[model samples]
Target: MPDDFAPTPTTLTTADGLSLEAQWAVPLKHRAKVVVAHPHPQHGGNMHSLVVSTLFAHLIGSDCAVLRFNFRGVGRSEGEHDFGEGEQLDVRAAVDSLAQSGDAQCPLVLAGWSFGADLALTCDAPELAGWFLVAPPLRVLGDERFKAAPDPRPKWLAIPERDQFNPPDQAQVAIADWTNAEIHPISGADHFLVGRTDKLNALIDSFLSAL
Candidate 1:
C-alpha cells in the first residue's frame, strides 16, 4: 500500500483522563497490529514526524492496523507534557485504541522513532509481540529497563550509520544484553533520516515480514 492510504482521525483517552489526538488505518486481514509512537514533544516531534508518518503511511494498507498519535501537550492532544513519563500512557492509549479495532488478538508490534523509541522501551507493556526502534538515542535514556529485565521479544534496532546520538557501533554495545535484539544499520543516513525514508520503510517492513 502507498503512503496516502487515507487515515481516520480520532481521539484516545489515556488512563489518566488526558485525551490525545490520533489517526489510524486498519487492514481487512489484520495479520498484524502496530502502535507507532512519535519522537520527543520537547522538539518538533509529534505523530507527524517523518519517520512515524512514513511508517503509518507504509503500513496502513498492508495487513497491519496502524495507529499514530501526538503525545500530551502536542497539537490537539490534552494536558501538558510530562516529558517521557506521561507519554508512556499515551503510547498505551494508542495500543488500547488499536486493540479496540478489528482482531484485538492480532500480534501487536510497538514501533517508535528517536525519543519515541525510548518511550516504547520504557512503557510497561509486556503484550507486544516485538519492538522496532528507529534511530534511538540510547546514550541519554532508559538503559536499565533493558538490562534489569531484558525482554526476550524480538527487537529490531534500525540505526543510522552516522547517527548523531547513537552510532551503529555504540548501539551494538548498548543493546548487547538484549538477547533477542538485532541491529540493522541504515547506510548514509542520519538521526532524522532526512532523505532516506524508503530505506527506513524497507528495513521495518523486512523485520515485520519475518515475523
Candidate 2:
C-alpha cells in the first residue's frame, strides 16, 4: 500500500447492531467519498481482497475518502451470514458511517466486486453519486431493484474478458437496459481481476474523475 493510502482501523455498527471491521483512507483534502464492499464472505472475501485493496491503493491521493469493510460473519465482524439480505443493511450502515465524517455534502460513490458488486447494485442508497461494479455474477444475484427502474445516477460496469462467472458478452446481455450503466470490457481479466488490478483501478479512477 502507498504510504499516503495507509488506512486507519475503524469499526462500524450496522443498523441492526452488528459490528463490522473496516478501514478508512482519507487524503488531506477530499472532494468525495466512496464506500466499497468485498466479494462473498463465505468465499474468502474481505476488506483485504485484492480487488478491494487495489481500489483502496488507487484512490490514495485522488481527493476521495474511501471506506472498505468486512461484512457480517467475516473477519472480526459480528453476526452470522444473512445471505445478501442483511448485508444490504451493512452497505447502508457503511454509507451512514461515511456520511458522519464531515464529507456528507460531497459526492458519494459506491463500489464492489462480484458478490460485493451485486450488493452494491441492490443497495438502495439514493445519496450515491455513482456506482462501480466489477464482474458481477448475474446468475447468483436475483435482485430486481436495479432492473425495475432506470436510475439516473451514473453506473460503470467492468466485465472481465475471461470471467469465470459472467463475461463481457453475458454481462452485456444482462444489463442491456440497465439505467445509465456504461459497460467496459477488460482484456485478459478474470472474475478475480488477478492480473488486471491496474486496469480495474484505472477504469474506476477514470469513472470517478468524470463524476
Task: Using TM-score, give the best candidate's number.
Answer: 2
The alpha-carbon deviation from the true structure for residue 92 of candidate 2, after best TM-score superposition, in angstroms, is 0.7
Give TM per candidate.
Answer: 0.92, 0.92
Q: Which stretches of candidate 1 lie over 4 Å from their true place?
A: 1-5, 145-149
Report lDDT (Cα) of residue 109, candidate 2: 88
The window of 10 residues in a row where model 2 has the poorest summed lDDT is 140-149
lDDT of 2: 0.82
Candidate 1 lDDT over 34-120, as tens digits, reads 899888888889999899999888888566788999999999999998867777788888877777787867878888999888878
Model 2 spans with C-alpha error above 4 angstroms: 1-5, 145-149
lDDT values for all models: 0.82, 0.82
Worst 10 residues of 1 by lDDT: 140-149
Residue 87 CA error for candidate 2 (Å)? Answer: 0.6
The lDDT of model 1 is: 0.82
Model 2 Cα lDDT, one tens digit per residue, 52-124? 9988767766777899999999989899888888888898888778867845677888889888888888765
Q: Go through the candidates in order and give the clash count of each.
A: 0, 0
